[model samples]
Target: MVSTSTLTYSPHHLNAIVRGSGFPILCLHGHPGHGASMSVFTDHLNPRFQTIAPDLRGYGSSRTRDRFQMTDHLRDIEALLDRLQVDRFLLLGWSLGGILAMELALRHPDRVTGLMLVASAARPRGSHPPISWQDLAFTGVSGIINRVVPSWQWNIETFGRRSLFRYLIQQHTPLAYQYLADSGMSAYLQTSGPARNALNAALTAGYNRLSSLEQITCPSLVMAGEADRHITADSSRETAHHLKNSQFICYPNTAHLFPWEIPAQVLGDIDHWIDRHPQVVASSEVSSQ
Candidate 1:
């Protein structure tokens, strides 16, 4: 049965949800989303594999400062796992979460049995796509400003284009627009500086992180949306090419929000991949900044 609960890992209090029972699947959220975002996929997973989705530091019920960066967020995940007494588990990161998952697989390979990187790139350096002023304007400045002062009364209102905004709310009452509006403020304040920092870091780290990717020992799945406007489809292809043991998949007609747009398909691919890689080296090492 699917269940929702909260846990405190020392200094930080985290809001999380779990479902099914068996091998644990840790779902990490991307920008502007919290742990609750996993509800879409958790509902479709097989009953055998349990799922744990947590609100990253400073998002949702996870409390922290506004300048909290990805490294801090990763440490929060480690602490949460420690609190739960889970020594190891599969990691699934969507978008920004995907970047975190990649970091975990590289730095803490001992703890991560497998990895799923959805719609992420390697820091966007080197020969990576040139960042146009328009791209930066929308992603960096415009996005930050919009979060601080949203145009919509509700969060998912922008999805009105495909009627998905309404349908999702109808399906999952907890994901209503009001919940986003109510929960967004804390995340907005916490991620403001960190988000900018991450963007800057991405520009410098980009294609340069290929060496780190090559060192990944865990099996990985790199999934991208065919129609993603933010990260190009080639990003996933390049990520797979860099990793020692990795595969890639591109979902057609979907944008960056493939998790919400195609949960069943994504979950199916994940379940199958995990089953295929049942034996992984234990990971105890942590990422070195």
Candidate 2:
């Protein structure tokens, strides 16, 4: 029944997708990606649990001024949940969204019944690898060439457009490329340049949350791609270590886009974990703000 609008305005006026009817699963997309970008996971997870995927401010149709900070993003999530009347539920985050998930779990200790981090890290300042300058130069050159030349391709710009989304998927897999292109490219490219810049700055501002993870004593799940270049698997493994109650899984031959790369398996794992917790207070609680 994977039917979802994945668009339109929430009561709070944020752009989001709400689907299915069961225990809630609030999905937070990574940087440069919108609610639709999470369709791969939400579509699968929705069969059992309701999924709430929202386009964070400054991205997709939730356009706002270019300037926004971590606080603003957090407020957006809080307000959206408040409007939705979600009392407690599981939270899932991918990449940058995962970091926000950690912060939010800490903020709403009672609201987040469980936490799931996909290809994410708590201390992103040091955990996630920085994109090299060479990538930037190539994306710019490719964008120029795309204006004139044809077929020859390169990435690194705004990801999913004339950008580096290819690098996120498992390399050399044509189906992976086409899958992401068809399902997520449009939303990824909709990112405003200034908003993208703002997100970039926030990521590099030396933000770290490792020491504070102990406070989030919720049942947590950390899934990582063994081949992820953006965020190392070891870092993800360590993120699980910080949580007093957490499990870590690494998939071989998968990269940063494992949710899209291996949707079925990922969903199975997520389902199994959620079944064990069932939002019981004694089971644990934890996500993105």
Candidate 3:
């Protein structure tokens, strides 16, 4: 729930929200999302875990002077971690942030105590896959609504950015999941269009780390929404298969923005997962949870 402090870090000025006082937990948001989106996850964790939610380089309030790569973001997080003197911590990421978390754990396995990936995957578009008839059924009426007279298209074109930002945060979630639409407006609006495009380009441009995921040996928790249009639950299952020590969970009747859909459950799951991994150990020595 913190995130007011904005500090200038290397590559770009990194604004972050550091709250609570316990084992550190660094949270990262998805593409076109800022650090604030992580508030849904970090808000309650403050009492049990120290949460560091930083706006990634070229994201949110961070300045996007030029096109940035995936590596640039990793460096920013590393620098911020170093600056804060956080030697080791748990990592939680959603969507694009999950990809980065995997990369970070691979690059520095010793530093990441554990990992929590929500509605995300190990690969790029492979995470989303192709929407099947079953998924279409899960989408139900919302799919028809969007296809016929999408709120996003209309808001962006006619209502201007103010309206567009609100819908974009919802990400076309069905009516049942649109209750928190207003809460996410600040996150989508702060991020620039170039930042979103760059992140998309980065994901689509040969961004596959499925093969390399086996190199990471940290305790990992992977969760996905059952009806997530952007990233499918099956893709998340595939990701868990590649990991040596990982647990996977798929929430029914949920979408890409599942955390917002059910905040209490998300927090409970995270707490239970973190409690299981008090000490980081290699997969060879312990069984996957």
lDDT by residue (tens digit), candidate 1, 186-252: 4445444444554455444443456678778778888987766566677777888888888899887
- Whichever of 1 and 2 has more TM-score, that candidate is 2
Q: Residue by residue across 177-254, what tens digits does model 2's lDDT show?
A: 445555455556777775676556666666668888998987999999987878888889989999989999999988
TM-scores across all candidates? Answer: 0.68, 0.79, 0.76
lDDT of each: 0.62, 0.73, 0.70
| Superposition error at 15 for model 2 (Å) | 0.6
How many pairs in model 2 have backbone atoms within 3 A of each other, for residues 3 or more apart or on separate chains, i.e. clashes? 6
- Highest lDDT among the candidates is held by which one? 2
Root-mean-square deviation per candidate: 9.5, 7.9, 8.7
Worst 10 residues of 3 by lDDT: 1-10
Q: Name model 1 segments beyond 4 Å from true.
A: 1-11, 124-159, 162-208, 280-289
By TM-score, the candidates rank as: 2, 3, 1
Q: Which segments of candidate 2 are over 4 A away from where they belong? A: 1-12, 125-166, 280-289
